[model samples]
Target chain A: MSTPLPDPSSEQLPFEPRRPVADADRQRQSWNAIEARLQEAPVKKLPIAGWGRWWWAAAAVLLLLAAGAWWWQGRSGAGSATSYDLAYKTISTRFGEKRRILLPDSSVVILNSNSELKLPADWLLDTLRQVWLRGEAYFEISKSKQPGVDYFLVHTDRLDVKVLGTKFNVNAYTAQTTVALKEGRVELLYSQRPGRSAAGLRVHSMKPGDVVTVDEGPVLTPMLATAPPDVMADWTSNEYHFDYTSLAEIGRMIEQRYGYEMEFETAALADRTMSGHLRADNLDQLLQALQITLNIKIEKKDQLLKVSVP
Target chain B: MTTGAMPSPDLQNAWDRVLAGHADGLRQIHEALYASMIDYACRLLQDEMLAEDAIQDVFVKAWQLRAQIGEVQSVRAYFFIMLRRHVLNVLRSRQSRRRQQQQWQQQVELDPVFSAEDIRVQAEHTRQQQQKIATAVNELPARQREVIWLKYYAGMEYQQIAAVMEINYQSVVNLAFKATQYLRKRLSG
Candidate 1:
């Protein structure tokens, strides 16, 4: 532990990773590209007086964003499979943060807090519209007018949901993958167990309001039912809507959203379930609601939250 | 190549100009930090073109978000932090693909013949010593390499490095110490 520190200043560290040389032409070309883009979007200067003028700029920016989205998606048709392999893009949200991402084909994905969605960098430009999800996301896929390439695929650890331009919410935070269909139809494809052959892959078709939760068992058991209107896609509106969700599952959601570690005073406390909604904007408020509704006491210390029966 | 231990006055001035809605300020900031930023980005993303594109996006985003950006302690750290987050997003997207490539690389490194070739190529003294240092630095884990680069090449203090890496000051100090210890052992033994 008493080893003297090595002085880095006295020694020459010859580990330079390709320092860019001052090439005049290259510099000019790079600067010009930046300059041209800057010209398209000017800095917002006036806070109040610029409101009227700002709306015009806002409209222009939206148009440019739409066009850029189209360009990225349109250019993907010519790229080879190798290019797609090298062109994966991941969009994620930090604790207590949510983001809305518009895919190449104009499919909208509202990623939940502490969630990640990985897809081809060019959006839906891949021959097969495919994406991988971890955590949770609400997807409103735009139906492709074209027949052969209309289906979209969402892969999780437990199952894959093949979509035909439907609105759905996917929660894959745990080993169990839950797909709640809000509108249209989706086909759930997964094997009963790992290392199963292609013939073992099971496909379960879903209709609107269908909620199928595939358990993380050696033999995966899928429980199919219908979720109430408010239970699904509620997080998208900044609310935690639970339909008799167990306290353990609620604790996991809290852990994911607020980066807190939850511990139960007794294992039995985790089994108690709660239903209905709580505003997700503030942590303390949500916890207070839990206390009032569930009659359990939660004590928070630093990064840990402990729940006990009152 | 050195931009002083203190925050560069030119960068601060350029940032002020950028806040005031002047394109020339951005140009000055770009010209000053472009080389170092691009080098850092290239290390994070092993693709040259992607690094260049990422740098360009950083500058463009900086200009766009100028109005909302609050006062920053150091301009260099701010730009580095911004670029770091941008590259991390890109890296996360390519995680599965890159993991496979890294597994293949580990298999190659495990081959005895590859180590023999490395030993035979170390015949020359001075040049080999330099190469050995480079290889040692490169062989360090990703976080260690990042710490070493930010400290030595970027000439940043531990506090600034912590801010750029979004870690605590103690964690940065520990990482820097751990990295130096590894490098010393590799170079001496």
Candidate 2:
């Protein structure tokens, strides 16, 4: 007789309680250190000491210097029509339209459809070039001959893009803020307002071919990695290309694109992440591709598709 | 379902101590509740690290927002709900990354031999039988798999599972029964 085959249930299972590893203790220590640092850091308080007065004076002097530097930089350029309060004026564009704005400091901005730009009425000659944007725009900043006075800045709802002399496109929609550096160098700050509190803004400098998305919160931090250049500008070309997108987010996108409701049968299945792109016109074709590619099943009842594991 | 209300006084005292920033009191609460929290997170994410991280973040956030942490209807339930939201956020974020074509997938797939009923079986014979049962369980439909996990792993009552899953309790019971029957057939085959 042949030897009896081992039952699958009779095999030694890998279920065992994991003991606390040495790394866990190290993690605990690191957490404690961080807590301690937070506790020790300066807390917000009313300043009352003589040294506090000195600190206030020092702060005032620094502010004046910064303002003076800004004014000086704004005035350094010649042959350009300069307005004292150019930034206070607001410029906007409607859908299916583009507007070219010539700032007094000689910086050029090409605003795309459904875009808005708000700048100061009088752009101080010696100060930083700053402007607010709501939609997509391409910036071509002119270089200043004077040192320390040539930096150009674009402010979005969540980020500040600074350029010395470069071309960049910023798509700062409320849902997603993206900065793509086409050439030269650009510095992205994490605020509409800069040079207030250091903690108020997080900054990142980008080189050409770099694209950053501010996805997490109000404070715009650059994404850890740049997306592929081909798919990064897909929105402009009406081509939707997602490298790896979750089903839940895809559900949201589907809702936005076709105005349909989609839900997952299980949270686990909802949590299932899929990566693919479809050029189809409707939801059924996209779901068909998704189902075949990801080994997922979609049950369509009326308008909703309940996505689940096959 | 049992309301399962514990003495509210101990929870209130614990809350006071936590509000006072006593580390030991916080640790005591953690010790009292960590198992259930970890289990809920594990059921949600199917990853131990992610579950642990969720628990740790819940504790840190609770401490940070101690002022806002209102009176305990049930501290355990409150803590579980909070941790569940955190786990959901993690899941949502992981899903977003997955949408972007990222390769990191948290392993949540259960072994095939561990049936929902087998989880309740404490005997050595059933422990030996777990592998076959788990395999059979894995072969069940997606809805059946979820029903099994919610019942056994999270220890949620049928009604509680219904509420959390947004499904009828009858459907949950039917799914569980079907899942068990499928496992039995697969094992016998």
Candidate 3:
């Protein structure tokens, strides 16, 4: 850190990046933009591009943005695939944030907070729809009876949920993969890809209301048959339903949804269990509800939210 | 190879006028430094529009704090410092945008830092020797790229570069030394 730059800099032949001449017209426009900006309130810094052309620029920018988006994907390698030229689309949400996306086939996917769903850039994998998911999501499949349209597949690290005209929930996080079918049928394929697992590893068929959670191995089990709507899929409505769940658990959900760090004033507060549904639209609303329900005082300091008995 | 640090009487008057917040002062200074600043920024950010935007932001910041800014020593280097900060900010925002939209999985080493090879790949200068220099420069890290550009391209002295880069003078010298060693090793060996 203390070394001095040598006299010749690098190699006695210091390199410079290529330089392009600036356009005089753009300089004049930028000057005008700055001058006009000076006349306005001194609070706002002027935009680099002239603000006069913003609205029209917005539409033009959208077209440019699409191309920019493609370049960005390639630059970042988010697609993480060997194939190039496919405009891969990724949808991710923070904790407490849920996003609904309609696929090209009209299938609906509602991603829960702290989750991601990625669709391949093109329909290149034959007629089947394939998606990669991390965290949790609720999917309502649109029955595509058209010939050549295969079933939809949602892939996780350990398992793949294959659906066709089925409504299902997939919770795939580290060390656990849970798939709960609401209606219709689905197939849970474990390490189903060729060369991944033993040849005998079979695809498990799932019936409606069937909940299968697998860890190191595929374990099929049924969740509550009449699991309350909130516990099952209340996230779709932007409401989280917790039944006798600990305050610590609720705090974790809020942290995941809103990216707020939750700190309890007393250890006992974390152990207190409550059951109810809280809105996920805003942090303030959820905090207010918590304050009223738990009889606790909540203090928010930037990214940290503190819970204490009032 | 002039550092643009040798302040002429005209440039001094421009500096005084900018301090006084005169319209002509701002115009004169902008005309004097606009193109060169853009070129310097283009080295940091390959996108021409982004480079332009960084310089425009620099002008805006300059105007915003014009009254408080007193007589300056090297107006060009001072503005160069400001432009470098803004370009870094733009690069950061672009990186975050990429992360948000595409979910950056791998660490992408943008070795060139908008070097000429990245911007003007087809400038009819792809001869063997030029190609070798380009390849060697492109292999350097972004920090080395900036230091190399500030030293040789912008013609900034070590002290001025340290001021512009907000690093200690010795640190700048050491960085330049390391960059030189790397280039020498690569270009010769």
lDDT of each residue in B97-179, candidate 1, tens digit only:
33533422221111001111122224465656766777777777777778877887677889999999999999999998997
lDDT of 1 by residue, A1-310 (tens): 2222233344332211232323444455567778877855754655434485465456444433443233234222211111212355555566666667656566888887677676754432225677777789999999974447779888776778999988999999778778999998899988875753466799999989999998777677899989775568887876788878998988988887668788999999999999877764456667777887989888877777888887
Q: What is candidate 2's lDDT per residue for A158-183, written digit by digit as tens?
A: 66687888877787645477788766
Candidate 3: residue B50 Cα off by (Å): 27
| lDDT for each residue of candidate 2 in B58-130, tens digit (9 for 90 to 100) | 7777777777775655565467667766776776655553444443456433222233333444456465466
Docking model 2 quality class: incorrect
Model 1 C-alpha lDDT versus the unseen true structure:
0.70
Interface RMSD of 1: 9.4
What's the lDDT of the predicted structure labeled candidate 2? Answer: 0.59
List CA RMSD, all candidates. 23.7, 23.8, 25.1
Model 3 segments more than 4 A misplaced: A1-87, A94-96, A124-126, A191-196, A199-202, A215-231, B1-189
Off by over 4 Å in 2: A1-310, B1-25, B39-46, B66-69, B101-120, B141-150, B159-189
Q: What's the DockQ of model 2?
A: 0.01
Candidate 1 pairs with clashing backbones: none
Predicted complex 1: DockQ: 0.13
Q: DockQ of candidates 1 onward, in order?
A: 0.13, 0.01, 0.18
Ranking by lDDT: 1, 3, 2
For candidate 3, write residues A1-310 as lDDT tens digits: 2222232223221112232345565567667756666665456644534673364345444433453233223223222111222244565665545566656566778777677776654432223567777778899988864446558878776677888798888877444667888888899876543433656466788777677777544443323334533266665665667779898977866665567788999999999888866754455666767777889887877677877897
